[model samples]
Target: MAEDGAAGGRPCPICEEPLYKRHCKYVCPQHGVIMDCADTFWN
Candidate 1:
């Protein structure tokens, strides 16, 4: 079976672990929030 949330198995950016879709954002351990990535893509 496939993993939850993501179509493939991808870890969080901050935590480098599985991403958890909490509330309305993709939360990570080290990064905390993975949202607004586009805004900081170049930064």
Candidate 2:
């Protein structure tokens, strides 16, 4: 899996909060938020 760089200003697709690099995925701490990176990046 290609690693996404540090998501400094990248907002969470769900909570709208800032995103952070977590392993191979961008994770959100605001549980229950459906954050699809692919969909978010395209839109």
Candidate 3:
């Protein structure tokens, strides 16, 4: 699995918070699961 800020180290699309890798998804502290493995990149 990739690190917290791996390939697409982008911010949350909704709130602009730092996104962290959780399992196969990217999560924002303010928002929840933002992106998953099925998706190409973190928006």
Candidate 4:
């Protein structure tokens, strides 16, 4: 099993908020609103 970094008091890089798992990755409102898994982003 992987470790939850935020559980140890880590903050998201951009928003500096507690990161919660949204789907496959962690989400910070200002930082990760764009899902990194997608291929066509601007489209």
* Pairs that clash in candidate 1: 14-30, 14-31, 15-30
TM-score of 3: 0.67
Residues 1-43 of candidate 4: C-alpha lDDT, one tens digit per residue: 3254343233566667765555445566567643332535422
Sort every candidate by lDDT, greatest first. 3, 2, 1, 4
Model 3, residue 42: displacement in angstroms? 4.6
- Shift in Å, residue 18, candidate 4: 1.1
Clashing pairs in model 4?
Answer: none
Question: Candidate 1 lDDT (Cα, whole model)?
Answer: 0.52
For model 3, the run of ten residues with the poorest summed lDDT:
1-10
By summed lDDT, the worst window of 10 consecutive residues in model 2 runs over 31-40
Cα RMSD of all models vs. native, in order, equals: 5.4, 4.7, 3.8, 6.4
Top-scoring candidate (TM-score): 3
TM-score for every candidate vs. truth?
Answer: 0.41, 0.45, 0.67, 0.38
Off by over 4 Å in 1: 1-10, 13-15, 36-43
Off by over 4 Å in 2: 1-7, 32-43
- What is residue 17's positional error in candidate 1, in angstroms? 1.2
Model 3 RMSD in angstroms: 3.8
lDDT score at residue 25, model 4, on the 0-100 scale = 59
Instruction: Estimate, for each residue in 1-43, the C-alpha lDDT of model 1 and write its tens digit.
Output: 3333442334765556766555445656556667633455523
| Candidate 2, 12-39: lDDT as tens digits | 7677876765643566567433345565
What TM-score does model 1 achieve against the real structure?
A: 0.41
Mind sharing the TM-score for model 2?
Answer: 0.45
